[model samples]
Target: MFSESMGRITGLVPSRFLTLLAHLVIVVTIFWTRDINVQASLPPDFTSEEYEEEDLNVLPASTEVILVIAVFVLKKKSF
Candidate 1:
């Protein structure tokens, strides 16, 4: 039956591998769409220097957010 075949396929692949694949897909999707996203979020007259400055400002905040989320996930998993 189809269900049986699907169950066998799922069992053959590790859950961690699936999770990594999903993460990679999402990262690639974001990477490809970022220019469109930035244009929508920024003013039409924005220069390259302004965009670079915005990117620099975001880097630290994004890092801090990732760290906080990582800590939260670790703590939750420890419980």
Candidate 2:
């Protein structure tokens, strides 16, 4: 179920790309055409946060640990 949810969130490659592109277009259109700012429109009841761009990165130590575990798992004999 967890894996399925992840797949749904990530979507199928090509479909995800198009969905993202459509979202980008809508955002750009709203920002460019309307004088209204997207950030300022948030509900006052909830704390609003500005969108910040970020690059995804995984820790090397974690990757190394995962790789080591994977190697051991794959090394098990008997099919």
Candidate 3:
């Protein structure tokens, strides 16, 4: 039932257009996140050492997350 509705919807739009739209969305998200200042999201009381340690912990995790998401997205849909 759900597949029937989705097929009808997709039938109206070319597959290439849908694929392009997905890529555009990913690019826009990356650019939008770039505009945000990470430090601005942190608490004011954070010391330099605390900030350094926080960065060390967060950077690797964030990087891994993005890479994982990109891989999943690309793998799910061949582009």
Q: Name the best candidate (by lDDT).
A: 1
Runs in model 1 deviating more than 4 A are: 1-13, 55-79
lDDT for each candidate structure: 0.59, 0.44, 0.57
lDDT of 1 by residue, 1-79 (tens): 2247444445334665567556656655655565666666679899998787666654554465466456546764321
Q: For candidate 2, which ten residues in a row score worst on lDDT?
A: 49-58
**Global Cα lDDT for candidate 1:** 0.59
How high is each candidate's TM-score?
0.45, 0.31, 0.32
Clashing pairs in 2: none
Best first by lDDT, ranked = 1, 3, 2
Model 2 C-alpha lDDT per residue in residues 1-79, reported as the tens digit of each score: 1257444333365575577566555645553533234334434443323322111122333455555556547866531
Looking at model 3, residue 43 earns an lDDT score of: 82
What is candidate 3's lDDT per residue for 1-44, written digit by digit as tens?
22474444444346756675686666556545642434555687
TM-score of 1: 0.45
